[model samples]
Target: MDKIIKTSKTIRAILKVLFWVVAVVSVVILAAILVALFMKGGTALDGGFSITLGNYSLLLNQEYSSQQLTSLHFMTFANVALFGTLSCYIIRVLLNVFEPMSQGKPFSTTISVALKKLAYAILIMGIINLVLQIATNLIFYNVFDIPSLFNADRVESCSISIVSDGSFIIWFFILRLVGHIFKYGETLQQLSDETL
Candidate 1:
């Protein structure tokens, strides 16, 4: 048990560090996109725009039917950054819950409360991700003329994806159920401790 606890603590500490790095990087990237947009001002949407970071790149060169799409590429990056940061934060909260569990107190109120908070965060992020997925599909397929990875039809465009819409809702309910289970466990553990 001591070895397990030590290992758990070590892994959790590493994960916490990684999460902070990821969160910071996400925020920095988002800030960079915003700064670039502001620097360009009105001309930001007038012509082609592209930003490359390492191996990845965002390009908007095709003629768009609506002027609104001129900023869609930037919005896409911003959305990605927001999602990444939020995910890191969620994981960080989860790590907090684990810290107590790793110390041999698995059914405490702190764990239950953190689990509940994590569940709600997952649900909220799920809804936001669903909306973003639809927008992304539309933007990438229609505006950018990028083909779908799942679909073989190259020209056919679709805004909705079953995986994105279905999976998040399913996970939200699952996590909420787990959180309630943990709360029940915490109550039982408290009762046991009191009787002892």
Candidate 2:
């Protein structure tokens, strides 16, 4: 129990730092996009810019119109920003669950509630991501005339894919089950406390 509490505290501290880092990085990306938009004539982003951030590297050597480049940047930025925001929220939910565990209350109602919140957040984000992916794919294929990466040969007739990979749905069910298990643990903990 002492070890668990210590680990929980450590994880909570790390999550706090991660939340702030994600928030700051997202804000910086957004600010950069806005600045580029305002300084379109003077910015290299409109012409050829090598974007090497983290694992993503895009070298825009081909000539593209300013509007096309800006649109691409905005879409890319929106995707990154959305992912960062969701990651921060998930971290926050994890922190909430860990707080009680850090205080030696592993089976507290707070943990159950936090688990449920996390489950719901996962479900909501999954649906939103699915929608965005479909929309983005359609736009890239139809508007930009880009070949579909997923359906390489079927680019001539882009069809809407409703088939889910089932990863998110599986996660939602698993988290909900875990939340229920925690709720049962909380009940047992309450009963034990009363008996004592």
Candidate 3:
């Protein structure tokens, strides 16, 4: 019993550190993206509060049509897909992270910790992406005096403002639900250990 308790605490501490490390990496990656955007798009990119704030004619019109897109539209679509793929990949890792944690095995605790943190980091970034999307869209519509190509009513809605707000909430909440389940699974593991 004493050995088990000690092992659990040690593992938990290691996992906590692993979580922070992955979170740090995620932040760094996100910062790198912002830096790249600034480097390429320039300081005007910083003047936000509107989607149309910048080159609305250029970015929005460039949407991926049946024909291949040429410039920023293609880039924008690719970015969305890239983020989605990354999120799915991270979610897969998170699912695996549960196995070791559920079994309370020390064998892959380190890997599990890393994956869990990575999943969290990716999920947070996804959420942030959604927020920025919605915000820029709002600024585009309201401030910049351009229409949202996505949806008129949806964009016009007052309540849901986050780039990923409203419908995105419904969609991503499913992922959030999975996260909560994983969280509860961890809690249950702790509880069972106490029971034992």
Candidate 4:
């Protein structure tokens, strides 16, 4: 039990650090995008291997009109911010679930509730990501006149893909099953206590 508690605490600490890092990076990206938009001359985001503190890079290389580039940057920043926030929320939920386990109360109702909430949060985040990706792709295709390589028939083949996380869904079901098992165990424990 002590070992489990130690591990849980370590994982929670790591997750907290990751959450803050992501949040800070997202904010920096957002600020950079806004600054670029405000400037009359557009800034280019080149990709290269370098060890710099605040330097950021995007996949796009070609020069774009100021308006188009601003729009693209805004969309990309929004996507990053949205996903980062969702990730932080999921991490926080997991930390909550782990807290009970660290205290040797792994089968508590709080853990079950946290797990259920985490599952739902993941589902919602996936759906939102799909929608955002499709929309952003459509915007890029139309704005940049980038023809779709996959489908030649369509002028703008902005394909919508469902980001399927099979493992996440599996975990959801597993958590639900475990929740039931915990409830049963609690019932048995209660009965045993009464008899004693």
**Clashes in each model (backbone N, CA, C under 3 Å)?**
0, 0, 7, 0
Clashing pairs in 1: none
Per-model root-mean-square deviation over C-alphas: 6.5, 5.3, 12.4, 6.5
Give lDDT tens digits, candidate 4, residues 80-192: 87887888888888889888777876666677678777878877776777677777877766765545223576454443344545565676677677767767776776687
Worst 10 residues of 2 by lDDT: 141-150
**Comparing 1 and 4 by TM-score, which wins?**
4
Model 4 ranges with Cα > 4 A deviation:
43-62, 148-175, 182-196
lDDT tens readout by residue for model 2, 1-196: 9999999999999999999999999889888877665554433434364544359765645444545556556666677778888988999999999999999999988888998889888998888788777766655445444442236664465444555685887899899999999999999999999999
lDDT of 3 by residue, 1-196 (tens): 4565466556656655665565566556655555444443223233322233335533432322222212333344445545655654564455455445445553343443544456456556667677557644544344333454457856654333443334444545555565556566666766887899
For each candidate in turn, the TM-score is: 0.68, 0.78, 0.31, 0.73
Residue 111 in model 2: lDDT: 89
Task: List where candidate 1 sits over 4 angstroms from the true fold.
Answer: 39-70, 140-165
lDDT at position 169, candidate 2: 79
TM-score of candidate 4 versus the correct structure, residues matched by position:
0.73
Model 4 local distance difference test score: 0.71
Alpha-carbon local distance difference test for all models: 0.70, 0.77, 0.50, 0.71
Report how far off residue 49 is in candidate 2 (Å). Answer: 10
Off by over 4 Å in 3: 1-72, 98-108, 131-196
